[model samples]
Target: MTRATFEIEITPNETPLLPGVGRFDFQKVWEGDMQGRSVGLMLSAGDPASGTAGYVCMEVFEGTVDGKLGTLAFQQLGTMDGGNQGLRYIIVPGSGTGELEGAIGVLNLTVDEGTGEHSILLEMSSDH
Candidate 1:
């Protein structure tokens, strides 16, 4: 399998859910921005690697999922790449289901033939 590598740096804006949560490191997938799109993002996240403590990382974004703006739809694809600890998860676009709730966590991604230097931000939001 083709392996994509990434150097991910996350700046925590809030730690209401995690008290000791600070800057965490992740190796993610580089899925490149889609053509003719306003923004772009890559999937990333993982479990506590020695010091970091959290759940599996999972997300789908384009530029920004939330903002000083209004409701925006982040189309989450079921397939993506990259992460350590060997776990799998996804976020789809819709409501009334069990996954698209208020619950939030990290998103780890990996892609084929990607490397560090590629980056994106994963912001939080509600399904409604």
Candidate 2:
């Protein structure tokens, strides 16, 4: 497998869906080792005080993956319960385009709690 990392900037707009449910639409710009942009939609529910909120997100990334040009789609599912948090992110099968066609991988996104710096790590099949 091959791994590459990229720094990301995300802009999100929250839209209320109901009393405790809402959606967030976001646009992401990525730089560093990978240059690209992505658009994402996310749905979240619950209150901060209760600490039982959860979210699911879908994002389409169009750009370079480790200097190789292509487009990819990924999904994220996460939940925060009390002081515990869990998240899962993965590349959508057959969603790679151009040079990334037929590529299979897992994607991980991380943020620094103090700095708020976001980054993505893509672990791809070596066959690509």
Candidate 3:
């Protein structure tokens, strides 16, 4: 397995879908060795003060993974249980296109505490 790391920026727009429910549209941009953009939609239930909430999202990324040109579909499931948090993001099965075809992996994200800079750590099977 190999890992690709890159910086990420997310712009989110939220709209109320129902009581205590919201729909979010995200525009994501990637930089620093991985250049690309992604569009995602998320459904979130509950507010921050609720202490417990969950969100599910689907994002389609059109970009390069470790310099390999292609596209990937990502699925994210996240939840906040009381004061704890659990989140997972993975590449959808068979969702890789072009040179990324046959690629399989899970995506890990991290944020710098001081800079608030986001990064992605993608671990995938070689296909290029």
Candidate 4:
């Protein structure tokens, strides 16, 4: 398994899916064992002003993992309630392309409260 860390930048998009919902597009720059970038879209619902919300996101990542160049797709599910939060990123089955064919993994994310910096820890492996 390889562990890679990354920093993310999210931008709100003008596309509105529904009232009281938010749509955002994001880009991530990965470092450490994986060097690359990922582009994704996020859809969020619920009340963020009261610290209760949920979101789903899909992203396609293109980059080098363990020196292998390819692209992989991920789906993220997350929720926040008051001071508590939960998030999970899963690799889409059969969504790997190029050198990442047959890739499998899980990703975890953490945000620095003081700095508001977004980071991810990807635990990844490939069957190819």
Candidate 5:
């Protein structure tokens, strides 16, 4: 089984690039499900109301790939366009599966129309 948890911080939204406006920062933690390699988020652009994109970083803290400690780096999970996309995860190899228990990461979020800005707060979690 896998579990995902997150905390968000909002920022000013961009306008002329989006109608539904808001920005968010992501901080999340996960428990490995697929042999401790479980990481990633399934993103959806909410609706036609959502006219922005989403990008995030996934990092590993306490983990190993074949016994070698995992590195601290952020990989682009994917783009969350204005539509419904399925679930996904960041790959940390042997590190995420069972090597990590006190890992930390950050998520930089945005929502805009390229004119104005609005930031929102959201907390989300999932387990499977």
Candidate 6:
């Protein structure tokens, strides 16, 4: 397993998808073992302002993981309620290309409340 950390920037899309849903586009700059950038789209529902909400996102990451260069896709699901939060990030099956062919992994994310900083911890492996 490999662990990597990253920082992210999220921008809200002006175009509304639904009455109560929000759309966003995000970019991540990864560091540590995995070095590169990723772009993703997110759809969210409910109200985070009231401390309850859910979101789903799909990201395409282009980078070098442990010196192997390739691209991988990830699916992310997350929810937050009050002081509790749950998140899961999984590599999309058969979505690996180049040196990362047949890659699989789970990623965990963390946010620092005091600094409003976001980071990720990726546990990744490949069939190749």
lDDT of 1 at 48: 38
TM accuracy, model 3: 0.82
lDDT value, candidate 5, whole model: 0.35
lDDT of each: 0.33, 0.77, 0.78, 0.87, 0.35, 0.88
* Top TM-score hit: 6
lDDT of 3 by residue, 1-128 (tens): 33444444444555556786777777777775557888888888866677788999999989887788899899999888778988899889899998889888888887788987777777788455
> By summed lDDT, which 10 consecutive residues of candidate 5 come out lowest?
119-128
Descending-lDDT candidate ranking: 6, 4, 3, 2, 5, 1
Off by over 4 Å in 5: 8-26, 29-56, 61-76, 94-128
Task: List TM-scores for all candidates, in order.
Answer: 0.30, 0.82, 0.82, 0.88, 0.30, 0.90
Poorest lDDT segment (10 consecutive residues) of candidate 1: 33-42
Q: Which candidate's lDDT is highest?
A: 6
Scored against the true structure, residue 63 in model 3 reaches a CA lDDT of 87
* Candidate 2 global CA lDDT score: 0.77
TM-score of candidate 6 to 2 decimals = 0.90
Give a tens-digit lDDT track for model 6, residues 36-117.
Answer: 8999999999989898999999999999988899999999999999979998889998999999999998888777889976
lDDT tens digits, residue span 1-128, model 1: 11222334454434244444333223233333311122223333333344322333333333213222222223333322334234343334342123334524333454434543433333344545
Off by over 4 Å in 4: none
Higher-scoring candidate on TM-score, 4 or 6:
6
Please give, for residues 59-78, the per-residue lDDT of candidate 2 as tens digits.
99898877889998888999
- Candidate 1: list runs displaced more than 4 Å: 1-9, 18-53, 56-60, 63-84, 93-108, 111-114, 117-128
Which residue pairs clash within candidate 6? none
